[model samples]
Target: MHYLLPARLDLQAHLSAWPPTEVPQFHPDALVRLLHLVTEVPAHNRKLAKQIRQQGGYVPLSAQLLQSIERHYNHYLTYAVRSGLLETDGRWWPTTAQVAGKCRGYRFTAAYCTPHPDASSDEVARQPRLQLVHLTDPKMQAKARRQGRRPTLLSPAERRDLRLREQPHAPLLEWLAPNRTPLRLDQAAALAYLAERFDMLPPVVAPRPKWPEWRPKWLKALDRDYYASPVEQYNQRLHSIVRLANRQLQPSIDTTVGRLHTTLTNMSSELRPFVYADGYGPLVSIDLVNSQPYLANLLWNPAFYTKSSSVKSTINFQNFRQSEIYKGRNVKGIIKEIPDIMLVNISQLTHREDIRLFSSFTGSGQFYELLLNAFRQRDVTLTTRKEVKELVFQVLFTRNGYYSPYKALFCLLFPTVDHIFRLLKQQDHTLLPRLLQALEAYLFLHVISRRVARTWPQVPLFTVHDSLVVPQEYAGQVEQIVREELRQATGIEPTLKHEQWSQAVRHDLLPPTSVASSIELNKKNR
Candidate 1:
């Protein structure tokens, strides 16, 4: 186990980059890498490192490598101890047997699952090394197929056998949920519906309040309030952070504002000509065009009417209103309904506890109810970043996002409060709707073929605000469906951000090329 690493590393290149005279006696980065390698490589020694060395096995460990390993031993060994993977003996020692055992197990498991039968039950039972307790029925290889690795017992159904889809263990994913729900609050109805949540919904990140120290005005105003020792001096530190956060918010707003406008334009017109009217007949005056009748022709005249939403979809002037056909999914549910308003709450916490409950008017149980109702009522989709990933974003945002000078509203605010306020103000105003759409697409992908649905399917035409500019292929029917779903999802009529957006493309914000081509959708795109 004390084997020296077979060093295939470029000793000359390292020397040239950092001449030994200018460099420390040992290379810190190299030492660090060696430490990490020795720490994670079970049953590892310098010789084992040599085995993993990419060089054609020609080189032996060098003084520099040995020096680095020696210098960084403590750091590496400490990490190894915490990882439960190595032991410290003035050098990080990998569990050589553990590494080999796991790999051998995996190999045997893999070999067993291969098409060719390697052994019978009687033969496997005789091999003491092959533990067959969890996987007795050799022929029923569902687990093996699902895992697609080890030959286990009865094959599970395809739906239940998504064994390969699990994400690796990450500490942040460990959010505390009393049951299946994330931390939330509840009040006995009789105690008071007119309590904390009544004033405003509890913050999504708020922990229970410590009301005694530098109490919030609202809490003090309560005729009857409870006492808890709050950390008030920390308010100064939080306020300072908020000021810094404001400085950072302006640039993001500027960046996102441009994207919002760009997407809007693409939805309205610029991308239109590329996708639509590839060979559709030339447009003359609609009044004049109405005189002709065929598969496509306008019958009613007095056109260019903005008053009628139906006219835009028509194959000809008279048939616009009749064009829409397909209904959007999820815009309505069978038994429940809810409004479109997005609710947001953010509270700064003094204690980062394991049980971090975000108080709620209705407990998290109500979240299920709300979701069921929403699911049952409409066919709209929603989007969210992975919880751990989102929390990381939150931390970043808290540090440098959404707190700024132009955002004078958040002055003297806590980072958490400002962070929430800005998320609702900027993102909820525009991105929330889009995020909802992303959520729907994600669910569709999960329920359908995760990879296939994610990469290929879902005809997302294009989007502007909550409205999407679908292809003219669905040309006549797309608008009607969007309108229908918009009504059901947001309780508001949705309009196509653009029409004939493809035909007219100009960034100078010039007037429409001609009166005939000046569609409304084209107008918003510019």
Candidate 2:
């Protein structure tokens, strides 16, 4: 909620000259709020202090953000520029205009600005050096606007926004974790570790021109976004891990799918290696292989559709319409009207040979490798497990009409499975992902997490999606429980991978090893 302002700006004196009649949004408090929108980094994140040193003293605001801020008060930005708070490139785009490249926006006038291609070094240095001032007063925040309209009268977006902003965090479900005790962690020790790592990190630098040819190892596994710059990503990761280690933010679970989200989940996977839990050094995670595809494979089992079957209630599609995923999806009425048609389709597809093959591939964790080999046989360009894994998700979860060469290849390979997938999402594309996630959460959170907690009361438990992260000493025992429970429930012998949190590289990239292998390695070393 805090904002950034120029250190030299005399805010009280400046606001005293502006009469309420002449300027409304420029009132001292509102002006700071306006700056909040322009400042992309959070004040609580001290990474900004380092970012300022690395990326020159000024931070650039994108055109889209500037436009969003302008929507609130059109004249505020102009006032800031006139008052020597901000500097712009003198280019403006209409809301409807589609700029060919990234749209540039205003930056806070900094004491030492990065030299631009168009400006001389001396000119950039001579530009009045300004220091960023952190504004921390909660009184400066905009008061919540109360819409006098009834809940039924509000627009869907407004209601959703209101709910998200106002909703209080609820307790974890007993079925998921009977132990309602707070998660134990040595916060001071974790913070000390994180601070030391932060201090050791080199200054953040923009990627070189040949960045795509070769980049830092940490950059490899990151989800690619063309819109975000590398420098931005690095700074954000630094900020997130710092917040998490210090426990400034807490862990919470989503009620709809029973998925737990915490500070650990929010940070980059590459940074997770350095993090410890409950003072347990060098943790490891037991991850279900191809979790989504494996979950989807369960739907092919006829037992999954039977109410008497133990698995049915856990991932019952009958309850999906009531879930939050379909709140505004407009599929409830269609599902209600055609429940029989859905059952018929499921019954017919359950015993197909293609489905059996699909189930086999996913269950054994050979699905990605199978696809990669197939692509290679067909002389297609896909060469790695990661490439095929991405393609599998696109085929399974993307809209029915979305066309890609990989999707076409997948449909041709398993026409029956593809048809069943399309049929499941005919009413709503979201239904398929929701159903899969529900099953995953049930297996990991409810069955695996609950059992692990009861079996090893002293071992700290953490679930991140389809993985169970625990102390290295207990990884083998927990892995056995996870494997046994999943086999008993689904009748599939799932492939489980062990990832040591101490390793800089992902377990998949490293030589394949089990918790058993890790234990043996530790024994040999000892």
Q: Pick the candidate with the highest TM-score.
A: 2
TM-score of each: 0.20, 0.57
Candidate lDDT scores, in order, read: 0.25, 0.55
Per-candidate total of colliding backbone pairs: 40, 3
Give the TM-score comparing model 1 with the true structure, all chains together.
0.20
Model 2: residue 425 alpha-carbon error in angstroms: 1.9
| Candidate 1: residue 355 lDDT (0-100) | 13
Please give the lDDT score for candidate 1: 0.25
User: What digit string (tens of lDDT, one per residue) describes model 2 on residues 1-526?
Assistant: 2233443566766655643344554455556656644343433334543343233334445555444444445467667767666665665454555644423345666542333322323223111212233334444322311110112222467457445421211212221231232223333443355456545655443333223321222233322211233334444454454444333233444444445565566666766665554334457889999888877766665555565664533344444444443344333343453335556546677677777778788887788998788678888898778778767767766778777787888887788888767877777666777667766765676567777766655566777788988767778778989988777656678899998775442333233335675566446544
lDDT of 1 by residue, 1-526 (tens): 1111112223345345644343234443443334323322321233443332222111222334444345554443344234332222221233485562211100111112221122222212110011101222343323222322221211254114334321111111111111221111111221132232223532222332432222243233322232111111121222222212111111000111111122122221212232221122211110111000110001111121123533232122122222111011122120012112212111112132211221120123232234334333444232332322233223223333433231332222233333333443343333333223332222111221222213222322322323334333333334444344323322223233334433332222222233333254344434
Error of 2 at 22 (Å): 20
Q: 280, model 1: CA deviation in Å?
A: 6.8
